[model samples]
Target: MIIRENSMLSRRHLLSLLAAGTAMGGAAGLTTGVAHAQAAIPDITLGDPSAPVTVVEYASYTCPHCAEFHSDTFKDFKAEYIDTGKVHFIYREVFFDRYGLWAAMIARCAGPENYFGIADLIYAGQGDWARQGDPAAVADSLKRIGLQAGLSQGQVDACLQDAAMAEGLYGWYQENATRDGVRSTPSFLINGDMHSGNMNLSQIGQLVDEASS
Candidate 1:
């Protein structure tokens, strides 16, 4: 519960992290080996566990820049670094608002198998969903995304209405933000070092290579 100022889910501070940047990588053909990540934690990571470089991302679902990074940068990173087992990438959710929280629940509802796909949809449709500014509508839209991923409305609703899960997620965020000095969205923890702001493909590639070397 060590949120901003040692408070949990400090909404104001968390928004700054989302605004911080719009912001990962592959698994050396071993995605399944590590696919069963720490389900107890609110993290969904992909890549070879023994990758030389570990990249942790702190992002908010509502952040447009986050959407852009996922849309523009992630694919390449995933292909070269992650898929090749050059880096391990972890995605930790940072909730800036209730819309984001609801979205997080929906993504989790889809389960690990469909998490990334659902996340892609959320980021790609950020404008359409967040613009509504109505929690109920946004929640419904998120549920649709889940349904398309083959989830049931009841399942989605269960995750959404489960206030305990939301708190747990927020707690996870607080721990990440505090431990990693995450000042913005898309902040990265590269091998335990904090690097804020979104990085381009080449820049990230070089960093990973350097770390590997």
Candidate 2:
């Protein structure tokens, strides 16, 4: 769970993984009052930045538990908290494998403005895209996802080939995940306290109310 400095996420390891991932095709949450700025983390954020409560989510694109949270709980939470500007959400990626990294690249392909929307597509289609179990098939499916999300093939390819960006993201995830003691997907730092596993909207709403109050 603790991926230290010597872990496979080192730039060299990631590059090698990328090469292997290419043969495979691929693949593949938060809130609160304004979360304090962390310039070092490369996160895609949502809601009002100046909102009173900041909620941070750590998740992987290929994680089933994460998908369930997105499918069952996130809609209500987003409606009640994020849209109303009661919480600011920051999404941090956790790379459990190369497939996850590939998924992340696809989400980032459309750029931050469309990142969450693309992510929703990824999670919603997880059953079809990830169950194929062929790296090449998975990769193709992810590109289709990118296309569905309004990305050109060129944009998707560019995002996938950005080795430097991928390496930087590896380090970014490593540092933040370790610092926050994140050992699993669907983990959250609700106002800076780590909460792991799935949580209902009501549970999350109460936490947000408490943090913002």
Candidate 3:
């Protein structure tokens, strides 16, 4: 799903989506311009910055296939490449819905140091949290995940209530996904080549090896 540039996310929608377990009463206006906001959002990455293979993965937090990839394939892949500095891995969040966006916000709230760990937790519990009743319930589940990741309640609430950050993430995702021709979750840009769907370790390794060559 391609989110167009003109479709700006409103603060009211963000607040409502995450109002269940948060103190959004202190939510502020979207004062920051989209361009500036996008610039402020960082692309948290892993592995060696100068590794031979550069793999950019576009995945939605609410995607079941993405969850499967994270749970089953990612550990082996990371052990073989990321931890050993053989691959420069970049994980970009694709927001197919407000739920996915909220999840990304929570994972990001943990900061870069704990970003991947929080993301793993989100994926590990996707079946439960993503389907936890309504929008408010989902928000509550995500808040619990944030807490489990050692994030303070105040930090999670603040991150979710940041209208500017939310807008920026939306704009940034739209721009990146559109530019990279990402039409689905669990998509990969292996050395500038696009690959889609859930990929196993062997498939990824083959592509990474080919890219390295």
Q: Which candidate is the best by lDDT?
A: 3
Off by over 4 Å in 1: 1-39
Model 3 Cα lDDT, one tens digit per residue, 1-213? 333234334544643454433333333422234233443688889999999888999988888888989999999999999999899999998776678888898999978988999999999999998986576677778889999999999887767666667767877787898799888778999989998888899998999989988
> Which is better, 1 or 3, measured by lDDT?
3
At residue 173, candidate 3 shows an lDDT of: 84
Give the better candidate number (1 or 2) by lDDT. Answer: 2
Give the clash count for each candidate.
8, 18, 0
Q: After superposition, how far is residue 135 of candidate 1 from its true place, in Å?
A: 1.5
lDDT of 2 by residue, 89-189 (tens): 99999886767887888898777889889999999999998778676777788889999998888777666666556666677887887799877777888
lDDT of 1 by residue, 55-140 (tens): 98888887776887899999999998899988999999986566777788788886777789889988888889878955456667
The TM-score values for the models, in the order shown, are 0.80, 0.84, 0.85
What is candidate 1's local distance difference test score? 0.70
Name the TM-score of candidate 2. 0.84
Q: List runs of model 2 lying over 4 Å from the truth.
A: 1-11, 21-41
Q: What is the model-wide C-alpha lDDT for candidate 3?
A: 0.79
